[model samples]
Every structure is written in structure tokens, then in C-alpha cells.
Target: MDITSQKSAEEASGRYCGILAHPTSFPSPYGIGDLGKGAFDFIDFLKKSGQSLWQLLPTGPTGFGNSPYQLFSAFAGQPLLISPDRLRESDLLKKDDFLDIPYFPRDSVDYGAVIKFKTKLLRKAFSNFQKMNNADLCAEYDVFCEKHSFWLEDYTLFMAAKEAHNGIEWLSWEDSLALLSPSGKAAWKAKLASETDYHAFVQFIFYKQWFELKEYANSNGIRIIGDIPIFAALDSADVWACRELFNLDSKGFPVSVAGVPPDYFSTTGQLWGNPLYDWDFHRNDCYSWWISRVRHQLELYDFVRIDHFRGFEAYWSIPFGSTTAENGHWVKGPGKELFLALEKELGRNLPIIAEDLGVITPEVDDLRDSFHFPGMKVLQFAFTDGRDNTLMPHYFKSNCVCYTGTHDNDTTLGWYGGLDTRTQDWVRRYMNTGGSLINWAFIRTALGSVAKYAIIPLQDVLSLGSESRMNTPGTRDGNWVWRYYQKDLSAELASHMKQLTELYGRHPETSVWHEQSGFATLNSRGPQS
Candidate 1:
């Protein structure tokens, strides 16, 4: 798709609804989700459920305890997510090769064993590709490299160097290589050319499999939404290659890190250790790095959600060596200047959803509204104090998006069941219903809101509890490993979702509820005939 020809604000103002299910949540026999049959099946499920959007977490190669936000390379796809089944169909793998693997748990991903097993399989597939001598695939690989060489070459080299150094962080390498000197880079490239090409070939297959899945979804009226974190991991290829783009010290460590100050959620505040961007350097370059980042994402997604949107207006900067986020101070950010540059370069107002959940200042709201980007409202945050909280559905504007629960929150049922009596009573009173139907009630409220888009986490839609939660913000272990079995997505669930979506005018254009006078179209001009 040509992102430059995206719909204007007016054309995009439709009552689109979707589900938030990361690719990892898709069912697979590989012990983790991959770009395989499970992915295509999930897309079919979304189409049957009357959904048009399929929101996903960052698809980058994860690092540092397997968190997607802390990636090895901002531009590289997770090689572990490449589908063995797809490789087999393409004649690069065989079923007999996978027959000896140990049984994997169906309910959750075991990243450790899965990584070991998948890497071995990927190596075999790479060997097969080298020997098969298929001119067509080799030609396609060349085209892929040319199209993505801007980032791919560097990422492939970075991974090759990491392997050469036995997986040590880049900063710990020899001084010349750590600093990315010209002589050091050229020498390493010459010595490790084969390893670099192998990694690049892996990316070629990963992207090929991913685009095939994405094309299937789009053909079925399902749009894929991708995520972009506000900050990059300190130990990333992006920061290592472009040191001047971030606030790194002489030793290539963050001088001042990024985090949020104490908010209503916690007394100590959230300390996100991602490195801070050097806005001055970025502004001097007219945000060319940012433009490339957004451009890369637009190629893979129909819409992009900018996580930690508040940071763009004013970021919380913790002084070097701080133990907690409480010591951070709010620093001014690049703000509208960055957006204007993006608009000029992209030649279109990008479809961005602001994660305006934390301590949002008026400046942040103004920045988000200026571009007419939809801001997010999570329902789980609504009943904390009372039904009158800002996150409540009744207070949402038309240019906003609402969620029953986000990845960071416990599943809706778990949240409601664990709430205090006062909070639970307030929630019940607000909806005028018992708590037995809390998940459905929240889903209905979000869909019936004035917000233009309503998204429900797949866990919430399935009415799962804490066991299905995607992540816990401050924890490092036991995150991003949840999975669902194929049987979990039953015909009954699809039928239920279809009825609710049709009732609330969220179905595709042809299935709207015409008789319901209360059903207003998303745009001011009202429903189509």
C-alpha cells in the first residue's frame, strides 16, 4: 500500500472496531506463534467476527529478557517468529526434520527452548536455500535486500558482530569497533561477510512470510496495526550504529535515561530504562531518522500507534545513576516541529494513535489534537476512583479510541473480580448491571462510545483472567509468553462478537443496523444509505 495516499481525516472517520492480539498470542504447535497457518486462521477469525483492525505489539527482534520493547535491532524482524511450516511449503524445510522435537506446552510460550529449537531449524533451512539454487527465490532475495538495504545491511552486520563477540553488548567491544570507526567497520565487514549474508537471508525469509500473511489479511478487509515505542533500547543496533542520535556518554552509555515520574498509579513512578533521544541532534537533521522509522513501519501496517505519546510533548528524564523514576524531571521535547517535518516528508498526515494514558499535560493533548490523531482511552482505568474518571467512556471524544483493557492491564474479568467492593459497586452502578457480565459490559460500553475506534484485548474478549495478561509493567520475567489454543476461538465466540458489532454499528459497511435510530454513524454526516 502507498502510505502517501492514505485517507484524509474525513475519509478515515469510520466506526472501525478491532481486537488487540499480538502475533505471539496466535495459536501454534511450535510452542510460540509464528507467521504460519495460525496467523492466517486468526485473520479469518477477525473477518468472521466483524473486525477490520488487528492490532499487534512491536514485531522487532527482542533482546534483554525477551521484551519486544527492548529489541536487538529496531529494524529487524524476530527470526524466531519465522514459520517452519511456510519454509517447508517453499521446499526449504522438511516435516521429518521437526518430528524429533520435544512436546511443547500448548497454553504458553517457553521462549528459552523455543529459541534454541527454532534457531537450529532456521539454520537447516538456510543451508537448504543455499543448495536448492532456485533462481526465482534468489532473485526475490536480491530484490528484498535492495529494497531494505538502508537498515538491513547494518542490522545483519550487527548480529554477525554480536555472534563474533559471543553475544556481548556492542559497547564492550574493542574501542574502535564500539565507537563504529570507519576502519573497524570495513575490516569487520570484510572478515564476517558470509555470516552477515546468512543473517540477511534469514530476514529475507522472515519478511517474505510476514508479507504473505499481511496480504491475506488485507484481502479479507483486515488491517494490521503496528506499534512504535517512544524510546529505543540502549543495547540496540539503532543506538549502536547512530550514537549521536541519542544522549549517550563518551563510553556509549545513556547519560540520562527515560522514564515517567510518580503518577496516580504508583508512588515510586515507572522507571523505563530505555535510552533518551537527543532532540537537538534530531532537530538539526530535520528528523530524518524518525522519518525513516515511520516509513519502515508504514510498509508493514495500515496504522501505527505511538507508545508513550506524552514523551513527544515533554519527556521525563531521570538523571544518570538514578535508582527510581521519582527523581526524573520533565524536559521539553521536539513537539509539533517533528510532526510537521514528518508530514512534509511523508506527504500525508500519518495515521497515528496516541497512547495518552499516563500523566498527560495540556501540551501533549494539544499536540495530539493538532494532528487529529486518535488518543486512547482504557476502560480498566475508569473504575479506579469512580465512574467519573477521565477514562470512563462517557467522557471520550469522537476523535478518540477506546479499549476494554490494554496489554499492561489485567484482563477485564480479572480486574473486576479483584477490585475492592467500593470500586466494584461503583462499576456495577455505572453500568446498572451485576458483575457476572463485566467483560461484556465493558466491551459494550467501549463499542457504544463516541470514540471512532473501539478495541478489545483478545484476552478480554475471551473473558480470560490474570493468567492471560500479556505483561506486567515493572517485572522482567514471565512476560510476553501467553498463547491460546486453536479451540479457544470457537464459532460461538465469533457469533457473539458479530451480533455485538452489528448492534453497535461497528460491522463492515454492508452489515450496519439500519433500523436502530440510536445508531449514529462515526462521521458527522451520518450513516450511509
Candidate 2:
């Protein structure tokens, strides 16, 4: 491992606990969570709760379905997350911009309204910036554009062209643009230079604000853990700009797509219509694209959790026109060769957490273990099977990260409430606790387990029910809209969480709060209620 990778590994090695909450869940008045006071307040809450980490969902710009995993560009920060207050602070916006702010719900994001409002403000900010004469800021923007031109130039042009074509899919555009012909690219660049620059300007502001927030979190001793999905959406800048890297045909239609086969969960299975990677081509190119992707993610986060990590060893590929994933077949993936190439360029001992869920094979396990990357264990999956279930806390290893539930799963209380009586009884018997306040029971169990890291979703901490769930798999609507209010982060709640965290030896360094709070000693049973 190089110095950077070694430092990251060291940071991730200790026993610690954190809340798993996305930035969008942070409370704000601008109809969405942003890198404003709400975000800084969240970091302060983490510190007061004795947390050293803050795990997040993918921060990329959401595309169709308003899902972060389905992004416009894997390398771009979500413009929606840009704080209007921060813009005003930078003199890019003024107080008049907030005069017509809409009334947004405190508990959920109305994405449609939020998008329209934020888009207008962002455009205004860009226009204000263009009319300004600030040499320092302009120079900084120029540096950012030049530094990221490898992906920025293509991304901006793609966005501009998509806008020009009334937001239709690239394949439906003129053949020259759809195919990304050299002549067509040059002509479009010249024709849409101003619009493309506007998009680039948006990125510059997004990154400037995002990095400031990241730095604040780090300075507060809280490391951010970001997510990176394994597959890119077919309607993404990635597939639109680099066609040869994907399983697309001459007419830019997918030859085969990505999906998993039928399981007990559903008879037809899940058909995720993402274009599969042309692994042979990637390998021949030394996995340059994958390397750049990983490098960019590392820059945006202290540690990255690669979603659907098992796909690295092998993935399920389905025919393009398949209605369901039942007809998909398992195909070999790039495996260690890709990671080896990444390590050669980025460094070894990469700070990666593998989402090793689903039907993982020995090959996948081998690939994950080869790099000593930690796999995840969701506690909610433990009691569903039997005592021998690997997800049980007793079966957990110190090298793994544990969670009560992920963004895809219901809140811990909701999951427990819906469980069959037999399983519910088993859960109570295993944890040796009454069924009341089951969310806290799960949180305590996770923290006390041998897993090196335990992450409890904020909903579980707040004892929220199904309505507060972040997402539900295999569903299209009513997802990724959950938000929390400022009042939800009560001081008493923080104190309770801190007590449990310290009791489990998950707090960083010596616990002055535990000592001052009259705890008998470390790991003592100190007020479990």
C-alpha cells in the first residue's frame, strides 16, 4: 500500500459507529437538503453522538426516476445538492432570490418542485457569475474546467446537446451526434459553446461548495463514506460519450443488458436495463475507464462502498428486449485484472467496502478477500433464515461493516413489526430483549457485535416506521424522498446514542463523556434505555 491508501486503511481499522443518512435527508428550507447550515449541523450532531463516520448514498446527479444510482454523469456532483445560501455567501446570489421560495414539506422532498426552483436559482447564479468581473473566482473556475476537462468537456457537451434535442434519448438524435462522430462533436461544440460553458460553470460551483462541505466534515473528525454503483444507466453521459466501452450495437441499441435471474423474492426477477460493460475491451485498454472512475470517487470521499460488488467477479446479462430477468445468464466479469490495474495507478489496499449481497459465489468471495476489502452484513437479514445465518452478529467478523438496514430496506422498527410471529420471537430470544423499542435493540446489537464498523440508519435511530423508509427495491415511485427535521436531532437522543457507543467501545479514543457521565467503566451496562 502507498502512503495514501495506508492512511485510509488505518482510518477505517478501528471500532467505530455512525449513522447512515444521505445528505438529502438533512433538513433545509430550500425544498431539499444542501451543503448549508443543515449539513454543518449534521456533522456537529455526529460529533456530539460520538460518531467518527458519516455514510452516504451516491452523491451524483440523479437522472430518470430521481434515483442517485441512476445518474446523468458518474463523475458529476448533484447540482440539486448545491446550497442557495452558499451561493448568496459567494455573492453569486442575492436576498431577492429567496423572496419567492416555495413551501416545502419538512418530512419529504417534493423533487419536482425542488428541481424547478433550484434550477432557476442555479441558472441565475451562472448568469450573475458571467456578468461579474471577479478575476480570482474566474481564474478558479478556469482551473477547475481545465483540470477536469477529460470528462467535463464531454459531459457538458452531452448535456447541452440533450437540451437542444428537447431531452430525447441520444439514440433518437441525429445520427452524427448519436454516434459521437468526430466531425459532429466538433460542430456541436462550436455551435453550443455558450450553453456547454453554462453547464461547466454549474459544475464548478457544485464542486466548490461540495468540497467545502467535505472539508468541514473532515475537520470535525468525521469521515464521509460515499457510494458508487457498479453499473451506469444507459441514458447517462458515460454511455452517450463512450459507446465502445459498453454492449451497444451500430444503431446505439444495447445488444444485451444487465439484470439478475429469478429468485425466491420474485418469479420474474429484476430486469435492470443498464448496458453491460464490454469487459474484453476494458481489459485491453488496461481498464482506464474503471481506473478513472475509482480515482474520481476517492477524491470525493474518504472511503467508497462499491454497490453490487459481486458483479466484479461475474454479472448477470440479459437480452435487451427481455421483459423480466428470468432469461438472464451469468457472464464472467473483469475480476482481479481490473482492480490490479486500478491499484497500479491509484495504489493498493484501496479503502473500499464491498456490497457483497445477493447470490455471492466463491469466486466473488475470493476476489473480495484477495484485497482484504470488508463486506457488509445487514442485521435485518439475520433472523429471517435460521440460527446458522451468516448475517447474525455471532457470525460476524471484525473486518466487516454491519448495518441495521440499508437505503433499500425498511427502517428497523418497520421490518421488525412486519415480521412473522415466529421470526419476531426468534429475534427477541436472540437479542434477549423485549420486543418494544426493537429499533434500539438492533442498534445496540450491531454496536456490541465484533464487526469493526456499525452503521445505524437515522430512521432507525429516530424509531421511525415504514413511512420514513428511504427506499424500497423493485419500486419506481415514492423513493429517495425521506427527510428529517432539525428537531429530530434531540440532545437526549444524542446522549443516549453516545452512551451506547461508548459502552460498546465504538467511540474514538478515550471517552471523556463516558467518564464525566458517571459511567462505571468502559463496556459497563450504563443506562440501556
Candidate 3:
């Protein structure tokens, strides 16, 4: 509410309970879920559950690995997520296109097979278009290309270059393609014109389908919360196309990468190989790049959660070749200057959530508080240490967003099942509840907390165990593939949750929760997709 000065008091009110499920995890016959019926049905499910928000992982085009955080382009949607069913409806594809459909795993996404099949399907769709060019759709495609030319042109060219070079990393491409020289760029543009236009057409399809689904969700009163990773992957177009904005060498290799120093997760620490930003260059441009990025996310989601929010105050910079984050040093970030620039570019009221987890300090807290962005609280991290138990519900403030567990952590039941006797006892003593019905117990405890927004992962809501857990940090393979059946969303489950939400005065439709007025009273406030 502090960020947006435009909305009325009535508009700024409501305590919300939401579910976290990435669109890729949606149940579908396709190898991966897409922006099609599955997404719409999930919206229907959200409305049925009385959930106001649908939280998702970043939907940007994935590269290197299938990790959503490591994206090819910050602005482009994943073409793999484009539904063949939706394409059929649009007449871009036919039943024959799916003649060789691989039997994908119903319980998990097979990213490899999905990619091959979807790529072939998309190319076939493009080929079919050559035979039948629908005038109206073509006109819309032209307008979309014109409007998004700034990002689309570079993205399409980048994708074509990737294809031409047999999908090698940008840095390894030929000098002309890597540096984008004047004559070289012109020659490639002419030669790869067809390939580039194909990529752009795919983006147009992604944009059209995604916005249509978003509109459906909005119409049903379900708001979306999207994520923004703090740093871009070194291999991403965001860094490659704008090499000057990152701390990169002449060959586009990062001088310093981004990661945290040693802590709870590992003694060596998690060394994320994303390129560190050139804050001085960004500052010189008045943070225009960041403003544009924020603007794009704001348009996509009702609320944007900035992952690794502490990075804005101070980031951990690791030497590019380091194997461990222990060798990293903390470097100062752009801080409030960046967000103030965002506020000016956007509006007074910015809908942002700060993923204020990990090694945090008072400076980070101050930065988050200054923006009035809600910091996150996870229940699984609460009982890990006695003195460090700031995550306990009793310590929670109403302005924060609380979760039973996040994607990085195990599901609630999974976490409980893995806990030792002492920790389990501590959890019991704290909640005044035994091991029985632990998942629902945590759900109830989260809803009943002072926090204004309580969001539980879909796995916790369904009482699933480790097998259903979405992602485990520090792993490369066998992650980001969990899927839920349509039948998993039972009426009984929805009723149970709605009862708890209403009982705790946490139903978003009723009133907004706030710290100053307390949960019983009323105030207003405001992540990641």
C-alpha cells in the first residue's frame, strides 16, 4: 500500500492465503505443462479453494539446465511451455502434429523429451503457417513484433545464433557472432532472417497465450505473484546482449560471479555461477535496465517477489573460477537508489515482495522495510536452532508473508518425517500439536499466524511427502518436475482450507491484515511466480 498512491482504501484491503505451484508443474498430457487448459483449470481450482494468489517460479525461457532461475532471456517466455492444444485451436497445428507424441510421465516433467517433441511441434506449426497464413493472426503477430522489437529483435537473433552454432554457449560462438560486429551482424541478420522470424513468431504465440490465461485468472479474482532472480545466469541473453552492464572480460567471461559465503547449507557454501552486475554502469544510466526489467514483471504479475532480496543491499561476489562460495566477499549493491528509480519509472505503489531469506543483516532488513516490501518466513527453518528461531510463528509480524516450506526445502510432511526426536518434540511443543495430521496442522498454524499472507506449497496442501517435493537446492538433475493430478484438488480439501482461512480472519475477500491494526482489526498490504 505504501508503494501505490493511486488505489483507494477499499481497494488496498485483504489478508490472503495462496498456493505455490509453477505452471510447469500443472497436470497435462504434454511432456510439460503449458499456458493452456491446465493453467485455466488451476485458476478455477484457486477460485474453488478461495485462494486469492497463485505463486509461481520465474517463467522465463530456461537455458543451460532446465532451471527457471537460469534463463536464456529475461523477457522471453519458454516456447516449450506453449501448448500444442492451444495451437490446434489457433489452427497453427493439427491433430497430425501430435501423431508421434511420446508418452510423457504424468507425475513428473521429462524436460529432455519435452524439448525435442515441442520443438518439432513448434517447427511443424511454423511450417503449416507457410501453407496457410491467416491474415488476422499475421496482422497481430506483426503488431506484437513491432511493439516488442526492442527485446524481441535481440532475443530472436540470439536464439538463431545459438541454433546456428549447434547450441553452444554465447561466449564460445565465433567472434563475429559473439561480439556482434557491424558487418558480421548484418550478414547473420540477412542469413538467419527466417530462423530469427521463427523465434519471434514463437514469442508472439507465447505472449498471446500467456496474457489470455492471465486475463482468465484475473477475471476469477486470482492474482499472480511472480519471481525475479537477483542475478542473471552468465549464459543468459540478459548478460550476453548487454555485456557492458555486467562485470565481464573482453571475451564475455565473468570476472566475478554471484554466490553466498559459507553458511548452513554448506561449509563450502553454494557457488551460483551467475555474473555479477556492474552497479557503477547501472547507476550511470539511472538504473534504466533494472527499471525496464521491473516494469516487465509488474505487467506480468500482480505482485513481484525479488529472490535474494538482501543482494540489493550487499551482494556476495565470488571470483569467477572459484569452486566454493567460501572465497567470496561481500560487495555493496545499488540499494535504495535502484528501487527509488523503479518507483519513479513505475508508480508510488510498487507491489513487491522481498525474498529476505539466507544470511541476513540489519542493513538488509532496513532496505526491505524502507520499500514496505513483505519479507518471507518459512516454518521448516524455525526449529533448526533455538537462538536463530526467528521463523517461529510467535515471532512473526503481520506484514510478512509466511510459508510452511519453500521450493528449496522439503515438503512439510517430508520435513517432519526427516526430523529427529528432539526437533519433532520442539515442533510439537511450539504448535501444541502432535505428529498426527502434521501437514494440516502446519497449514492451520500458518493461517492462524499474525502474518497477513500465508502461502503453502501445493505439496504441503496435499499432504504429499519427499517424492512430491519440487526442487532441492545444490542439485543439478531430477528437479523441477513434480506434477499434481486434477483429482488431487478435492472438494473436501478446499472446504477444509476455506474454513481455516475464515476462522483466522485471513480470508482475502473479508479484510486485509496489517501489523498496526492487528489481524482482528483491518489494514492493507502486499512474489514470486
Candidate 4:
């Protein structure tokens, strides 16, 4: 859709809802989820349940801790998310290759095992692609490489060198390579030419499968909402390729790191070790890096949610060696100057959502409103203070996106159960519920809000507890591993969701929900054969 049509639709269809699920959480037999049958099936489930949007975490390749926020490349799609089944369909693999599938737990991802297994499989596919010498396929790969050369060249080389260095962080490499000297880059490129090509081939398959899946969702009237973290990983190709744009020491260590002051998620505040951006340099350069980043994300999703919107106004900067955020202080950011540059380059009124959740100030609100980007209102934060809180439904403006709970929060059932008795009673009285189905109560409240869009975590729809939580801020391990089974998306469940959606006037195509005529029986293809 063009920018004009998108604005028109936003004005017309003011109420919509969707589910927040990362692709890795989808059920699959080959360990973690990929852009395979499971993804398509989930899309089918969304359509059946009357959801028009599919919100996902950042789809970039993950580094340590398996957190999507710490990405290997700001521009490249996750190679691990590529579908081996699709590769087989493309004659890149044989049926025998599937015979050796390893056992994977149904409820959580085993990232180490999955990475090892999938990497081998991807390598096999890449070798087959090279041996086949298909002219048309090779030509398509060339076009993809050339089209994305601006970022892809650096990313593939980064990965190839990482492999050569036994997956060590760039700073630990020889000084010349660690600093990304031109001579070092040229020498490594010559030595690892084949390895670089292999990485490029993997990316080609990843983008191909991803766009195909995205096309199917759009064809079925489900627009995807993707995520973009406010900062890039310190060990990422973005920082390594453009070191001068970040606050780095001469030895390539972060001079200061990104984090937040004490907030709801943590007592000590979350110490996110990403290298802080050099905003003065960015402003001097007209934020060319940010412009390309936003433009690339816009090409990937219908709307991109910028995590940590307040950071653009003022950011919390902690010393690089600090373990906690206690010593951090707020530093002024580029503010409107950055957004104005983005708008000038990518066109006015970009389709973006502001995650205005943490330590917000009036200046931040003004910056967000000036661009007309909708900030978020999470229902999980509503009842703690009272009805008058900005997070409460009654206080929400029509421009915001409401959520029962975000990925960082506990599932609604889990959160409600853990509340103090008095707070729980307050919630029960506020929602006029007996608390039997607190999850559904929160969902109903979010959908009924004045916010233009309402999003629910899939775990809440299933009424799962903290065991299915996606992430816990400030903690290092055992996050981003939640998964649900295929049977979880039953036809009965879809009908119920559709009924609630229509009741809230959020369903676009259906004005009435028929109990007698329930949703169609599920014929979704199960886990990979």
C-alpha cells in the first residue's frame, strides 16, 4: 500500500487487533520454528480468529542469549528461519535428509541444538545450490546480492570471518580485523570467498521464504507488524561496519552502554549492553544510517514498532563496565532532528509505532506526537495505580495501540494470579469479572479500549502461565524459548475469539458472530512431515 492509502485506511478502519508471536515460537519438528508450514498454519489461525495483524519480534539473526533485540545484522533476515522444507521443494535437499531429524521439545526451543542442526542443514543446501549450477536460480541470487549489497556484503563477510575465528566477537580478533581495516577486510574476503558466498546463499533463501510467507499473509488480509530495536547489538555488523557512528573507545570497546534507570521490569534497571549511538555524528550526517534502517524495515512489514521510543528524546547511558544501571544518567538524544531526517528521506508520515512505555517524559510525548506515530498502552500496567492511570482503558486515546501484555510481561493468567489479593480484588471489581477467566477478561478489556489497535500475546489466548513466558528482562539465560503445540489453536478457540472481536467492533469483515455456525474446521498442516 502507498503512504496515502495507508493513512486513509488508518483513518477509516480505526479498530483492529492481532496476536504477538515470534516465528521461533511456532511448533515445528525440526527444533525451532522457521518460515515453513507452521508459519502458514498460524496465519490461517489468525484469519479464522478474525485477527488482521501478526506482530513479531525482530526477525534478524540472534547472537548470545537468543534475544531478538541483540541482532547480528540490522539489515539481514535470520538465516536460521529459512525453511528446509522449502529448500527441499526447490530440489536443494533430498527426502533422505529428513530421516535423521533429532528430537526437539514441544514447549521450548533448545537453541544450541537447533542452531547446530540447522546450520549443518543450511550448509548442505548451500553446497547443493552451488553444485546444481541452475542459471535462472543463480541469476536470481546474483540480483538479490546486488540489490542488498549496501548491507549484505558487510554482513556476509562478518559471518564468514566469525566462522573463521571460531565465532569469537570481532573485538577479540587480530587488531587489524577487529578494527575492520580496509586491508584486513580485503585479505579476509580473498581468503574466505567461498564461505562468504555460502552465507550470501543462506540469506537469499531466507529472504525468499520470508517474502513468500509475508505475501500469503497479505493476500489473506493479515498485515504483519514487525519490530525494530532502538539500538543495535554491540557485536553486530552494523557497529563493526560503521564504528565511527557509535560511542566506541580506540580499542573498539563501548565507551558507554545503553540501559534504563530503575523501572517496572527490574529494580536495578535493565542493563542492555549495546553500544550507545553517537547522536552528534548522526545529526551531522543527517541520520543516513537510521533512514536506511527504517526504510529497510518498512519494506519488510506493514508497520514497524520502534522499541524504546523515549530513547530518541533522552537515553539512559551507563558506563561500559557497569554491571547494573544504578550509575546511569539520562543523556539528551537527537530528538526531532532524527525523525525529521527520516521523514525527509523515507517520505512523510511513515508507518511506525512508538513503544512509549518506559520512563516517559513530556518531551518524549511531544516528539512522538509531532510525527503522529501511535504510542503503545499495555493493559498489564493499567491496574497497578488505579483507573486514572494513562495505561487504563478509560485514559487511552484513540491513536494508541493497546495490548493485554507484551512479550516482556507475564501472560495475563500468570500476571493476574501473582497480583496481591487487594490488587486482584481491584482488578475483579474494575473489570466486573468473577476472575474465573482472568485472561479473557484482560483480552476483552484491551479489545474494548479506545485504542485503534489491540494486540494479545498468543500465550494469553491459550491461558498459559509464567512457564510459557517469552522473556524476563535483566536476566541473562532461559528467555525467548517459549513454544506452543499445534493442537493449541483449536477451531472452538477461534470461534470464541471471533465472537469477542465482533462484539468489540474490531472485526472488519464480520459484524456478527454466529455461535451455531462456528469457525471452519481446522485442516492446517501439522509439524513438518
The C-alpha TM-scores of every prediction are 0.95, 0.96, 0.94, 0.95
lDDT of 3 by residue, 1-529 (tens): 3334542233365678889999998878897888988899888878876788889999989986688988888888989889889999988998877788889988899888999889998998888776785899888989999988878888898999899889989989878889877788789889999999899989999999989999999889888899999898877777767888999989889999988877666778888899999999999999998988887887788888999999999999999998888888999999999999988877765788899988999999999999788899998888887855888889888888999998888888888988899889888777777676577778878888888788989998887899998877777878898998888877767766655566677666644434543434321110000
- Give the Å error, residue 196, model 3: 0.8
**Pairs that collide, model 4:** none
Candidate 3's TM-score? 0.94
lDDT tens readout by residue for model 2, 1-529: 5634655657655687898999898999988898899999999999998898899999988877889888888898898999999999999999998899989998899999999999999999999999999999999999999999989999999899999998887889988888887888999999999999989998998899889989999888888899999999888889999989998989889999987777534568878789999988998898999988988888888889999998889899999998889888899898998888988998888889999988888999899999888899999888767789888898888889999999989998899989989889999898777878788888889998998889989998888899999988777999999999998888867877787877788888643344475455432222233
Clash count of each predicted structure: 0, 0, 10, 0
> After aligning candidate 4 to the native by TM-score, how far in Å is the CA of 391 from where it should be?
1.1
Candidate 1 runs further than 4 Å off: 9-11, 514-529
In model 1, state the lDDT of residue 366: 97
Better of 3 and 4 by TM-score: 4
| Candidate 2 backbone collisions, by pair | none
What are the lDDT figures for the candidates, one per model?
0.85, 0.87, 0.84, 0.88
| lDDT score for candidate 1 against the true structure | 0.85
Better of 1 and 2 by lDDT: 2
Evaluated at residue 71, the lDDT of candidate 4 is 96
The residue ranges of model 4 lying beyond 4 angstroms of the native Cα positions read: 1-12, 511-529
Residue-level lDDT of model 4, residues 403-494, one tens digit each, is 99999998988899899999999998888788877888788888888888999999988888889999988887889998899999998788
